[model samples]
Target chain A: MNLIIGNDITIGYEGEPVVSHLTFSVESGDYICIVGENGSGKSTFVKSVLGLIPPLSGKIVFSGGLRQDSIGYLPQRSAIQQDFPSSVTEIVLSGCLNRHHRLFGYSREEKARCRTMLERLGIAGLSSLSFQELSGGQQQRVLLARAMMATERLLLLDEPATGLDPQATAELYSMIDSLNGSGITVMMVTHDIHPALNAAGKILHFSHDGYFFGPKDEYFKSEKGMTFMKEAGHDHH
Target chain B: MIITEILSYPFLSRALFVGFLISISSSLLGVSLVLRRYSMIGDGLSHVGFGALGIASLLSLSPLYVTLPVVVVSAFLLLRLSQRKGGGDSAIALLSSSALAIGVAAVSIGGVNTDLNAFLFGSILSVSRSDALISLAVSLVTLSAYLVFYHQIYATTFDPAFAKATGLRCERYNNLLALLTALVIVVGMRMLGSMLISSLLIFPSLSAMKVARTYFRVSVIAAAESVAAFLAGFIASYALSLPTGASIVIAHMLIFIILSASGLIIRRIHSVIS
Candidate 1:
C-alpha cells in the first residue's frame, strides 16, 4: 500500500498556513525521514498526514489497500504526560481498542499481541510497572511497543529521539531499522538529521517557506541541502 | 453515641443514601476532571448551581427540577465557551460570578423567607426522599454512560491526536463529559452544598493518585476515599453540630494531606532501598 499526496496543501490554524504547497508520496516499505529546524512545520506536516490537522487545500489519497486500522503512529515522546497513571500493559492494550474486540474488554488475542510486542521491544518485564515510573528511554520503548501493537504496515514517528541519550538513540534507531527491514513503511519527523539519514532511503526537508521530497542522495547533492548543512554547522561527509 | 443516634434517625438514613450515591458519581467524573486539570471547574459550576437553586426557591418552584436544567444548560454553555481560543478560564469565571450575583439579587428582590442556610452549608436532615431518588438515578445513568463509552473516553483523554487520526469523534465525548459533570453537580449539591461540592470532586482523586498505579486503581481508591470522607463527615457533623458541607470538605482535605505526605515518604524509602 502507498500514501499519495497531490497539488498544493496548506496546514495550520485559522490565520496563516504553516506549511503550504506540499506534495509527496510514500510507497510500502519506504523509510522516509523528515528533517528541518524548529518551527519549520515538521510536526505540522506529520499531523496533517495523520489527519490530526485538516488540510486547507489539495488531497491525500491512500492507495494500495491501506486500511486506517493498519496505520500506527508514535507521537513525540515529550507530547505525552509521563506522569499519567497507567501501566505499560494498559497503554499497549489501548492500541487495540479500534479492533472491535468486545465492550469494555480486550480479547485474548489482543492480550497476547500486547505481550508479544512488549517482548519484542524488550519491555516484557515492565508490563506491570507504572508507565510514569519508567526512565525516559524505557518510556519511549514502551510507547513504541504500544504503537506497534495493532499492525506493522505503516509507522509514523515524530522526534523519536529528542530526549534520549546518544546510546539510547542508537538503540532506538537500530529498532527502527529492524522494523523497516521487516517491510513496515516508516516516516519520521526529526530535527537531528545524521542518524535518520543512515536509515532513510528518502528525505523530506522542510524549511520556513517550503519543503522538498526526493531520494536522500539527491537531496544531499542539492544547493539548498548543502546550504542547510553549512548553516546547521554540520559537515555532511 | 452520635453514630448510634444518626443510624436511628430515618432522615439520617436518607442522607447517607444520598451521600453515597453522589460520592460515587462525583468520583467517576472526578477522574476525567483531574486528568484534564480542570478540577476547579467543579467549584465554579457548583457556585452557578447555587444561583439556580436560589432562583428556583424565589420563584416558588421545585429547586430540584429548576436547578437540574439550569445547571445542565450552564455546563453546556461553559463547554462551548471554553472551546474558543483564549476564553476558557475567563468564561468560567464570568459564568460563575454572574450566576452567583443573579441568584442573590433574585432572592433579595423576592423577599424570600426560606432558610437559605441549608442550601449553603448543607443539612443531612434536609435531604428528602425525592432528592434521594434523583441522586440514585443520576448515578445509574452516569455509570451506564461510562461503561458504554469507556474506550472512546480513554482514547480522547490520553491522546486527542491519535483519537482523531483513528476517526473517533472526540468533540462528542467532550460534550458527554460536560453533561455528566452537570448531572453530578446538581445531584451532589444536596449533600455537599454548592459552595463545597468541588472539594468532594477534587480531594479524593488527588489522594488516590498518591498511591494508585493505574487509572482503574485510581478510580477504586478515589471511590473508597470519598465514601470514607462521607461517613466521617456525617458522623462528625452529627456530633459537633457542624455544617455537613464543611465537615465533608474538612474530612477530604485531611485525607488529601495525609496521603500526599505518605506518598513522599514512600518515594524516599524506595530510593533509599534501591
Candidate 2:
C-alpha cells in the first residue's frame, strides 16, 4: 500500500523551483534512499514531506493511516545541540509532546513507552545523563529512540551518519536495516552512496540538472543513476 | 536580619517585593531564552523599552502605556529576524543600538534628566504603589504562563524544526515566549531598569547552568538564585545606601562566581575519583 504520493511536485522557496518535475511514491515497508550532492533539493524535499515548507506546486499526500506529522524523523545534528543541557529521558519524552494527553505532564503509560524505546535503542542506562555528554553514535541512538517514541510506521533520516566514524556508521546503518526488516518504511537522505545505493530498495536521486526516482534495479540501469554512481566514485554493473 | 531590615522601611519593602518578582520572572524566562541563544533579545527588548519610555516622556504620557506595546512589537520583530539564518546577532545589535540612540535623543529633548538616574539605574524610593501593583500582576502572569507552556517551550527550545514536524505550532509557542519575555522586561524596567534588567535574564540562567545538567533543574535553580540575589541585594542596598540595581546585579555576579568555582571543584573531584 502506498503511504505517501508526491504528484508532479515542484519544491523550492519564493516560487523559484530548485528541483522540479518530480513525482514519487513511498509504499509500505519500502526503504527509499535519497542521494544527491549538497544544494540538490534533497533537504528541501524532506522539509516539504515533513510539511515545514509547502511545495511550489503539486500535491504530496500522506495516506494509509499516516498524518503529515506522524512520521518518525531523525534530523541532522545541529550546532545548538552540541552543548545543550538536557537529560536523555526528557529528550525522548518530547517526542510525545503532541500526543493526546494532559498539557502539563506525560501519562505513566507514555513514560513507560519512552523507557521501552530507550531500552530498545540500548541507551536506557544513559537516560539520566545529559545529552551533550554523549558520544556521536550514542547521541544518534538517543535521537532514534526519541523518533521511535513518535511513530512505528515510517522513518525519515537526513544524513544520519554525517560525522560518525566508520564503525559507528556501520552500526547505525545496520540498526536502520534491522528497523526496515521489521516492517517500517524508511526514506533517508544520505551521501552514503554504498549503503544508500545498496540497502535501499528504491532510489530518489536529486541533482542540479534534474532528478530521478524509481526502483533500485531500474535505477542501476538508468542514465542519471549511472552518472550519479560514477560521480559518487562507485560503479555498479 | 535581611527580612527585618527590609520591612522596616516601606519603600525598601516595596522595592524588594517588586525586585524579587522581576527576578523570578526574568530567570524563569531566561532558561529557554539562554538555551535558544536568544539571551540578547532581552537586552535588545529592554533597549526598545528605553526608547519607548523616551517617546512617552517626550509626549508626557504614561511610560507603561507606550513601552508595553512598543517593546512587545519589537520582541516579535526580533523573534522573526532570529528565525532566519545569518546576521541575526548583527540585526539585533543594529536595532538595539538604533533604539538606544533614539532613546538618548528623546530623553535629551524631553529634558527628563531629573528622573534619568532613576530611569536608568533604578531607585528603591522611586517605585510608586501603582508600579508595585503592575509588577505583581505581570510577575504572576509570567510565572503562570511559563508553567502552562513549559512542555511546548521545552520542545521548541530543544529543536523547533523537530517540534514543528511533530505538529506543534512552533511559531505560535515562540511568539508566546517572546510576548512573555517582552512583558517581563517592560515591568522589570521599573525595578531593574532597562540598563540593568537584561542582567536579570542572563546571570541567573548562566549561573544555574554551571551546576545543573537538566533544563528543569537549571530553570528552577535560576529562579531561586535570582530571588535570593534580589533579596540579599535589596537588603544590602538599604544597609549600605548603594544603587539598588547595581547592588542586585553585584549579588548575581557574586553568586555566579561561587557557583562556577563549585562546579569546577565538583568536576575535578569526580574525575579524580573516577
Candidate 3:
C-alpha cells in the first residue's frame, strides 16, 4: 500500500519554487533514497513533505493510515544544535513529544521505550551524559533513537551523516539499513549516493537537469544516473 | 539571632517573600530563555516596564496595572518581530532604548518627585504587602506554567525546527514562554529593577550549567542557586546598607564564580583519575 503520494509538488522559500513538478509515492516497507546535488531543493522538498514548510502548489496525500504526526523525522543538525545543553536521555525522550495526548509529562512506558531505543542504538550507558559532549557518531545514533521514538511506521531523515568519518558513515548506514529491514518505510535525503543507493529500493533523484523516480536498478541504468555515478567515481578518484 | 530579629520586621518579611518568589520564577524560565537565545528579552521587556512605570508614576496611576499590560504587549511584539527578517538583537535594541528614553523623558518632563534611581536599581526593603502578594501570584503562575509545559518547552528549546516538524505547535509554546517571561520580569522589576532583572534570568542558569549536565538538573540547580543567592544577598544588603539589587547580583556572581572554579577542579580530578 502506498503510504505517501505527492503529486506535482512545488517546494521552495517565499513563493519562489526551487524544485517543481515533483511527483512520487512511497509504498509501505519501501526504502526511498532522495538524492540530489547541492541547492537542488532536496531539503526544501523534504521540509515541505514534513509539513515544516508549505507547498507552493500540489497535494501531499498521506494515505494507507499514515498521518502527518505519525511520521518520525530526523533533521540535519547544525553546529549550534549539536552544542545545545541537554542530556542524551533528555534528547531521546523529547522525541516522544508527538506520542503524547497531554502537553507535559511522559508515561512510564514512554520512559521505558526511550531507554529501549537508546539501548538499541548501543548508547544506553551514555543516557546521563551531556549530549554536547558526545562524539559525532554517537550523537547521530542518539538522534536516530530520538527519531525512532516518534514513529514506528515511516522514518524521514535529512542528511543524517553529513559530518562523519567514513567508518562512522558506514556504521550509520548499516543501522539505517537494519531499521529499513525491520519493516519501517525509510525516506532519506543524502548527498552521499553510494551506500544510500545500495540500500534503497527506490530512488527519487532531484536535479536541476531532471527528476528521476524509479527502482534503484533502473535508476543506475538511466542517463542521469550514469552521469551521477561517473561524477561520483571521479570525485572518489 | 540576627536572622530572627530581621524576620520580625514586616518590611524584611515582605522583601524576602517577594525576593524568593522572583528568584524561583526567574530561574524557572531562565533555562529556556538562555538556551533559546532570547535571554535579552528579559532585559528588553524590563526596560519597557520601566518606561511604563515612569509614565504611570507621572500620571498618578498604579505602576503595576500600567506596566503589566505594556510589558506583556511588548513581549508579544518582540516575539513576532524576531520571526521576521532581522537579527533579534536589533529589535531588542530598538524597543529597549526607545522605552528607556521615553521613561527618562517622562520622569524628567513631569518633574515627578519619586526616586527614579530606586526604580532603576530597586529597593527590596521598600516592598509593600500588596506588592508581595502580586509577586507571589505572578511567581506561582509562572512556575505552574513551566511545570505544565515542561516537556514541550524542552523539545522546543533544543530544536524548534524539529519540534515544528513533529507537529508540535512550537509557536504556541514560544508565546507561552514569552508571556511567562513578561510576567516574571514585570514582578521581578519591583525587586531586581530594570537594569539587573535579566541577571536573575541568566546567572543562575549559566552557573548551574557548569555543573549540571541535564536540562532538568540545570533547572533544579538554577532555581536553588537563585533563591539561595537572593536570600544571602537580601541579608547582606540589610547588614551593609547596600543596594538590594546590586547586592543580589553580587551574590549570584560570587556563587557563579565558586561553581565555575569547582567545575574546573572536578574536571581536572576526573582527568587525573582516568
* C-alpha RMSD over true interface residues, each candidate: 1.7, 1.4, 1.8
Candidate 1 accuracy as lDDT: 0.80
Q: On residues B95-200, what C-alpha lDDT tens digit does candidate 3 reach at each position?
A: 9999999888888877864658867988775588888888889889998989989999999899877788788899999999999999988888977778899999
| RMSD (Å) per prediction | 2.1, 1.9, 1.8
Q: Which candidate is the best by DockQ?
A: 3
**Error at B196, model 2, angstroms:** 0.3
The TM-scores of chain A alone, one per candidate, are 0.93, 0.96, 0.94
Off by over 4 Å in 2: A231-237, B109-112
Q: Give the TM-scores of the predictions, in the order they appear.
A: 0.94, 0.95, 0.97
Compute the lDDT for candidate 3. 0.87
Clashing pairs in 2: none
Clashing pairs in 1: none
What DockQ does predicted model 3 obtain?
Answer: 0.69
> On residues B72-104, what C-alpha lDDT tens digit does candidate 2 reach at each position?
999999998887798398899999989988987
Off by over 4 Å in 1: A68-70, A232-237, B1-5, B84-87
Task: Give the per-residue lDDT digits (tens) of candidate 1, residues A93-205.
Answer: 87766665577667788999999999888989999999898988898888788678755678888889988999898898998889899888898887776755588999888
- The digit string of per-residue lDDT tens for model 3 on A186-237 reads 9998888776557999988888976899999888888777888877773322
Clashing pairs in 3: none
Instruction: Please give, for residues B1-274, the per-residue lDDT of candidate 1 as tens digits.
Output: 7777777888888888878878877887788777866665777789888898888878888988998998888787877776678748887898788988877777777776454666666667668888888888888999888777876776677776666665667788888988898999988887677888888788888899998878778878998999999899878887888888899889998998999999999999999999
